[model samples]
Target: MRSDYFKNTAYVRKTAVSSSIQKLDKKDDELAFAKFFIERLNQFRKLNYRVVSSDEESSGADIYATAENLETLNLQLKTGEPGLERFWGRRRKLGSGMGIIDVNIEDLLAQIIRDSEKHYANKENLTLLITERYQPVFDKNYALRISTMFGNSSFKGIYIVKLPSFRASFPYEGQIVAIKDIFGNHGEVF
Candidate 1:
């Protein structure tokens, strides 16, 4: 993938999001991967959830995994992490200018919460917007892009995650080696 051609480093940007998903690269493939990931999560059972869409929010979580599993809790899954990193540290590197980051994540987060609530309210189903998380190939804390929005307030920030961190948290065993590499030298399993 083209991501492989780039440096291992990660970047945090305030790039705008549009009403359409067409601008997103390989969206179909990404959705497919997200669905597959949701399936895997469901195999763990323990929780009953489904993939839901909110016209108000626009963005669809990989899965709506809900549970009383206090440890697991309720979550909205993203192909990548959802909460963003703070860009307060990047201001110094932008030639001592104003903050380098753009857009307020906190504001965006609020919009999501509002939309999520209003969406289900019409259906007469009470659903709490518990938490949002991302699933990335590499480091999570320092992912290539830590996109986030804090609801209830207009404050927002984004930060960059170094490559080294990504390498550490990446689900290597899940993707790097073939299924056989793990189950070992055995033949295919149906």
Candidate 2:
């Protein structure tokens, strides 16, 4: 059975999304990715989440959503490959032996902190969702790093949506690798 969300019959052709992504300059990629992500996210009708538009100047999250049993979620979307070095602390280049397809969990957390402090100060929870062009193989290790790093913050989760390629045949997919309940429970699955 094709239980994966991205495997839905009605899906965006990898070519369409990739070609579109390739044509965009860096400035517009965030918004473009946000739009694309939201469209795919809304497919889960059972979840009853409504994806709302956000204005860059005033919105803390790239996309906003409302659902039962939780406060408004601030989904701060980030794109591009994670850098080779951690933002703070010891600097070490990620060598090819470790693989180039990865997202820097530390840097992403820093951004979430900055964005949440500035715009999501009053919000209940924060999630940093990154959509990468290449498939990353380190989500499990990265999740453990995040849990150990920011175990006290209200930042509840980090999700990765990987779009393998723009070849029109590849499928776009995602998964919530790590999550916690700000209310006390750890590793809550969504």
User: What's the lDDT for all of these models?
Assistant: 0.30, 0.52
lDDT of 1 at 20: 43
The ten-residue window of minimal lDDT in model 1 covers 155-164
Q: Which stretches of candidate 1 lie over 4 Å from their true place?
A: 1-21, 24-26, 46-83, 87-111, 119-190
TM-score, candidate number 1: 0.26
Candidate with maximal TM-score: 2
Superposed by TM-score, candidate 2 places the C-alpha of residue 158 at a distance from the truth, in angstroms, of 3.8
Question: Candidates' TM-scores?
Answer: 0.26, 0.48
lDDT of 2 by residue, 1-190 (tens): 6666566643657767877777555536655555554454545323455566567588666667776774666677665355322321222233343343334556665565456556556444556665565433445655566556655555554554444345565443544333343334334322
lDDT of 1 by residue, 5-77 (tens): 4533333222233324453543444344434433444454334444533232553332233334423222232
